[model samples]
Target chain A: MGKHIRTVNANQAILRSTLQGRGCGECQASCQSACKTSCTVGNQVCLKEKKQ
Target chain B: MIHKFIFDDTRMVFDVHSGALHIVDELIWDLLEAYGALPEEELAQSLSGKYLEEDISEALEEIKELTDKNILFSPDPLGGAYKPPGESVVKALCLHLAHDCNLSCRYCFAGQGKFGGAPGLMTAEVGRKALEFLVNSSGERHHLEVDFFGGEPLLNFDVLRMLVDYGRSLGREKGKEIKFTVTTNAILLDGRIGDFLNKNDISVILSIDGRQGVHDAMRPFRDRKGSYDVVVKNIKSFLESRDYRDYYVRGTYTALNTDFSCDVEHLASLGFDNISLEPVVAGEKDHYSLRDSMFSQISSEYEKLTRSILKMTKEGRHINFFHFNIDFEGGPCLPKRMSGCGAGHQYLAVDPPGTLYPCHQFVGREEFVLGDVFTGVRRGDLTRLFRNSHLYRKEGCGQCWAKFHCSGGCHANAVIHNGSIEKPYSPGCLLAKKRLECAMYLAQWKNAPDKS
Candidate 1:
């Protein structure tokens, strides 16, 4: 009951322990999410996404 | 800004700007809901009915500590300070090699692959000019990508082969590394094509709409013959030839098959590791188009898919479902996160005749045509228009909790549905938010202590 907050990133506490260094770049748009696999660079929103 | 929610038994809060997540207990969760609106004593008074004075005080202390660390209620890092990159260089091009396709799928968005244009194939000369344009427009960027698209790129196999070779030589001469990818229905994929793809290190995107029955119903040939058998067989053999590397199967879910998770599971069961099944974009008049009424069903399917992915991961048979692939820690850099896909800016699409558009979806629309490969992007006004279309500039995105994750959604979808890029398609918005929730929830489960 006393423990109330768990941080997920480097800002404070370790929030996503298993996801610490995982995930692609900060996806800014839904290009990847919209067509993801198929559209590859169809929209070219997030530069860091793995090249299709 | 902070977004908080409860999934299963865990309560989590996400700081949008800093991209931080917090798991809080019930007391802290409730306190956060009222934290900013009232004074500390007033907040405690409001929650006194449920918690003791000592407990309320301790929870308040925890909240204070977290807030002081800037982990919660973080300020917008781009508050009027974000400046667009000084120069936008072309990085990727979707080259529509052939306007004519062998399949006439009912849900074909490109008007049966011709994209509302006359059936034609891109000549070798046009293909060469397109590659040269990309190389010249790329500026100082070392690595570039070119995707061979069409009614079917394989239909123009000879020209595509020559272009790939020419692109390789051009890359070596210009000090650029060009990566190639081709998206096809797989009707024409054979051993030779597969071998060429592998040798060229070109990635492949195979189109198959899940199970044989479902795929056959949606994607059929010009003769109305089901292409499921041929497509799957070709894909299987192609995967075998390439040793199953750098490829993914992409599908579209329409009103015809709202239970799309089954399709995802079907592909997984078929031994395909990477897969993407997206909602079909069609006019409201189209019988197979998704409407507001169907959202609940679609959402549930997404949930089912999430659970399936989690269970599969537990068994060491994880399928890389594209939508669920969210990187909280390693997402795009800051500027890209705010700007979204660089369509019309960093990316452009070339039709068979070498006419350029912002992206593939906007190919046939004359208004979106930027210029041809010969003259380069002459429509500077259009480029500027797309360049300024950022998440913050989008209408109604300010209050959305998932705005940062989706980066204001797809511009083309918005234009098609609402007639303006600033106005988002509400259905797509709702679907994207739901997917983001599922993705975040999956992330939570994967990081949970019980995960193996």
Candidate 2:
């Protein structure tokens, strides 16, 4: 039972890393962080969070 | 899990799983808050249709990324949020060390060029308090620069030393650096004084109009004796010292000595790197105003001066035309929000008596007083001056192309000439444009081949 649980935790860790990578890769590059591009007006339209 | 919070017109989204908070773009957050009940899929499709020509699948994928970062959050009929280069960052503080002077130069702006209206020096108590106020008021993580000025800063040696020591101590305590400079007459600069200045990293700007005849004609002692010899002797000694190579001494020339071509060369030969020539401020007597002919003559003399400096610079020398040109993009000189002059906004000058004027140039007039320094720096009156002062936002100046560069000239000069700060600063603005144009012409000429 202990061995099985350890294997499941390892698989979950790998799955989490994959999801994080995909999520970060798809976000708009121009809006690195919100504060950095706040002065620009068009940066608002590029915001992906609002689209969803 | 994603959590969203909004404050101060900013939105922050936090990811519980990653312990990371991502701030959303200001505009996007505002749009989201405006459109209250849009489903994520429908919103994504609409965004794709309206803005991007890309497929909805790609847009949805991008939205998922933002959602994962916690920068985007869904509303449970509750709430959600997020979000916020450099031109010239020149910050300068003109510190008035003493309201008194030892020698009365004929054209002193501080009214100290004469003996009558000179006030006493700043006490140690006042100096300490002022330094504390300056240090505390300035935000953390910004460069602090102090420029020592007065009728003459050297006359009040005790207070100067106290202020310097205080600055050094505060710098050490806060892990911040402070730079010091002084504008003075070369008459008081001896070998010992030069050594002390070099040790303390203080740059000296000496006022010497031109050669013996011209300098003496403009800047004479109270007893009317020529001070050229004394000042020259001091300059010679200071420049000949062992550490002279490291010392920075710039010559400041007034407009009265326009006829002295030889004097300009003399200054260059005296080992001065930078030279600043300024037009004499208008006074009660019509002593300094140039006639059309005289102005032409002065312009010719300036051309010669520029040639001399350019020649030296070619031979690995450096020179600066003080009023005409400044290296705005090169270094951090003063705290200017935009690439413009500081008047009525970034900084204000307060006199020894604690009266707040727009700048150092208008310290004497009562009508120009915004408030007393003792009360003004803490209150809202300083901001009010920006709104009410004509000099701050003149209609003509606002529409002018030179607005970004000159900021409509100094507020003090405007108030003095027009009797109201709201009027256009025509004199200074016209002079500044002429000077800049002349500098540009000279620069072009320097780069051109010798036609002769």
Candidate 3:
């Protein structure tokens, strides 16, 4: 009941710019900037979850 | 790529995409790593100088075996494309019996049972319509489940009773196994109610957090009094009529109780054999919310709980922890999976007035309302959204070592935590990975047989 796919794609683009610039690079190999939790740098969980 | 982690004596590698797990010895591990970089001939040459031909070939055989399973495969730069969710039959329906709750818990996700709407109870007419909807929409699935859900389903005990009778009658006529389940706070449970539940063979999910202080601190009556004493008394009374094995003691751990293993211990001490602990879902500002800082502590507590279970298991008492019994083979196979639980696809929740929802979590949210019972289902818009919300459609799930197993985790939590269902809640995402790792560790170290 929502036109979310297009908005999601657009938001993702903006999020990518903001998060990546702030060092919160995308972790999932499946999608760009897919993880939304504020996992700080050097967090082991984020490190392990990142693409190998 | 397979993420490999080596322990003291064993090597574990997870193929996130294919949903395969590989646990090998040091030699086979070396072989797999070497093969990833070198061709078979070159790989053999590289490892041949250090090992015997037979041993190397055995390792090669292992690789070949893994290759057959797609656990080991050549990488192609060509990536995947979004595949819409296949038409899946509805096998389970959650019936929200009451929109009002007696306990106004601090972290109540449903806003104290009314969800976001005014307090109300479902009518028998609505319940009958919901049952009809489930039977109509469930396709040809011979096994169907109906869960009596609520702020406190007991609040609408009459409707629930009539619905169960109606469901049983319908099941007999249609030749479907209509299993019923109820998730309750146990406050309204009494001797007569318990007997009815057992006689009707209705499975119950009892909510009892743990020790008095902790349970009462989070969950309190509408009168602003602690509910621990009343809940425990009611739980014990309920079990007297029903077999304890037919129910699960479900608890939610908040930030206040990060050391939650003690809660499990308390439940176990009370002679409850089945237990499950879920983390509270709340905004970061909420005092009881599980924040980023508590992830490690909570994860460690789970580890402790696992150790305790192992000890109990060795002592000849087996306790059922819901996640530990997760059988991937018995679960949805790789091809049939979408991201997170198959909400809206394989499962649907019906609200008080017969409004259909994706699942119980989205019961009150207007944005997530798929449709109401009167108009059948508003399939086009919501269906396409859920169809496209598959793991493969999301670019972020690729190469995650836990992807196939986690299936990108829960959609509701993603939407709640990250402001979008398209994203992953990192804390939960990380905890799941940790849990999988723990489950794997326990299986191998305990010499547990392949339950898969």
State what share of the real interface contacts each candidate retains. 0.21, 0.00, 0.00
Off by over 4 Å in 3: A1-52, B6-10, B16-20, B26-35, B38-65, B68-89, B328-330, B445-452
The sequence of per-residue lDDT tens digits that candidate 2 reaches over residues B1-452 is 34344433335443322222334444344334423367765665556544443444443454455544332442211111100011111133456667877666666667763213458666766665555544554554244556666777787776777788888998788665666667777767876677777778776666776677777776777677888899878876876764454333333334566655566567767766555555566553656544445666665666566566667667767655453342211111111212123333334454555554545665665555665534445434544554344222564654443332344455555566686555655645655544544443443334334422
Interface RMSD after interface superposition, each candidate: 6.7, 22.7, 18.8
DockQ of 1: 0.20
| lDDT values for all models | 0.79, 0.49, 0.67
Candidate 1 per-residue C-alpha lDDT over B346-419 given as tens digits, one digit per residue, 9 for 90 to 100: 87889999999988889899999999999988999988888888777888876777766677777788889888
lDDT, candidate 3, A1-52, per-residue tens: 0110001011111111222222121111111011111111111122212323
Residue-wise C-alpha lDDT for candidate 3, range B359-430, written one tens digit per residue: 787788888888876677786577567656877655487757666556666767777878776787888877
TM of each candidate vs. truth: 0.92, 0.62, 0.80
- Clash list (residue pairs), candidate 3: A1-B382, A30-B395, A30-B396, A30-B398, A31-B395, A31-B396
Misplaced by over 4 Å in model 2 are: A1-52, B1-91, B113-118, B242-256, B260-262, B291-297, B311-318, B324-339, B353-355, B370-379, B387-392, B398-403, B422-424, B445-452
Sort every candidate by lDDT, greatest first.
Answer: 1, 3, 2
- Best-to-worst TM-score order: 1, 3, 2
> Is model 3 an incorrect, acceptable, medium or high docking prediction?
incorrect
Error of 1 at B32 (Å): 1.6
lDDT of 3 at B293: 81
